[model samples]
Target: MERMALGTEGIAVSRMCLGAMALGGVQDKETSYAILDRFVELGGNFIDTANCYMFWLPDGTGDESEHLLGSWLADRGGREDLVLATKVGRRPSFPGGGLEASEPLTSERIAASLEESLERLGTDYIDLYWSHRDDRGTELEDTVAGFDAAVKAGKARIVGASNHVAWRVERARQVAAATGAAAYTAMQNRYSYLQPRPGVRLPEGGHVHVEPGDIDYVGNTAGTALLAYSSLLSGAYTNPGKPLPEHYRHPGTDARLEVLDAVAAETGASRNQVVLAWLCGHESPIIPLVGVSSLAQLNEAADGLELRLESEQWQRLTEAA
Candidate 1:
């Protein structure tokens, strides 16, 4: 797979990022390790996870994903070859308290989360650390300064933001610039070839969708890259059993799917690969965070790096959406 710049910084990573959300909970340890091994074998270097990764299970716990990744890293060795990223905030519903009780992005929370993540991952530093979501209650400067402090203290190499809107990202950057703090170099948000309906709302929590204004901002930003989560619409484009997300099942979706199907046939690529190629070949740099539970799914994402779309084909797909 081809390696590309992760953000404005000098950091580089594989074109496609492997998401480990299902590592510990949905998939067993053995299966998760096999997938991770295959991903590394295929030259993937970027792996993303969050501290509060799956809290809804009956066991009522999180960090299972991080623990599994840590185990794999121990077996694999060569930690220098990989780009490790994890997020804080988004308190999962557990026993004592949840997101409703506490605000993330505070200096104390940021520092404490970093320490816990390091302990779980068995790493001293994180390549890219993210504020899982914006804490509207806290001052922007405080959040920026907190991340910068982590970077300065060698806890995290770089900081990023996820589930943030355009204005929030810009404001945070301005704060970082003014205070000489570490600014966000990349944005992780929900984006895909298919667009959600006008009135569609996510089963509400901390999830943030990418808006048109966010696209404009990223297009103009020099060093920032967009790490699009759910870039393949959760495999809706290819899997017959995987229906399109509820928010994305609008009038325009069928049209977009038709073009996607035609292009996939014409290019001799799978629908998943075609959608991924569209994101990679777009005007703005978008590195898709593809969540894979199996080695076959990981292979499909890896193969997508080789499927390039012509300008006309891209235009057709975009217009159809």
Candidate 2:
């Protein structure tokens, strides 16, 4: 796999980041280990997970993904070779299916959450740490300062934000600068080649989808890495069995699909590969966070690393929708 700068932190990682949201809980331990081994075998090192992953499972247990990675790292004994990333702040599901209280961005909460995450991952320091979502109730200054403290204390090398608005990102950076704290250098949001309809809300709460304006903002801003989740639209771009999401059911979706088909046919690539290639070759520093259940799917995603689209072809894909 090819490498890309994670942000302005002077760190680099594979362009494709494997998301382990389903590891351990939704996916069996044996299968998860196989996936991890295969990913590293293919020269992939960027892995994304969260402390609250798979809490919505029937048992409402969380931390399975991170715990699994911890064991894998222990057995592999090359933790320094990989870029480990995990997030916090979302409310995990409790044992009877109710949501537990979320950890806000207060200093105490951030510090405690980092301790728990480090313990679960079996690592002294994280490569990338994310605030899973914006805690609007808490002051942004406190959040920035807390993350800076993590870096200063050798708990995390760099910090990022997921599910945050562009203005909030800018404001947080500003606060960090003013307070001499570490600012968020990367952002993760719901993004794809196809877009949701105007005024259409997919996640409806703290999880916001990336809009065109967000794309423009990130591209114009320097020193920000944009990592896209849901980059394949949950396989709707490739699998016939998976329908396009409801929020993405816009009038232009058919046109986008047609363009994707044309691009794939022209490049002799799969539709999914073409979508990923588009993300990789975008003007901004964008990375695709892909989640896979099977080794075949993982290989298909990896194939995109070698596929390069022409400028005109990229423009066509961009203008399709």
The models' CA-based lDDT, in order, is 0.85, 0.85
Model 1 residue 138 CA deviation in Å: 1.3
Where does the lowest 10-residue lDDT sum fall in candidate 2? Answer: 91-100
TM-score of each: 0.95, 0.95
Give the least accurate 10-residue stretch of model 1, judged by summed lDDT: 93-102
Error of 1 at 21 (Å): 0.7
lDDT of 1: 0.85
For residue 320, model 1's alpha carbon misses the true position, in angstroms, by: 0.7
lDDT of 2 by residue, 1-321 (tens): 898777677778988999998888778888888998999889899999988877767765677888988988888885877999988788442354433366677877788888988998899999899999988888888888889999999899899999998888889989988888888888899888888888776654456788666677778877778889988877887788998768788779889889989999999999999999999987888889999988999999999878999999999999996
Candidate 2, which segments miss by more than 4 Å at Cα?
Answer: 93-100, 203-205
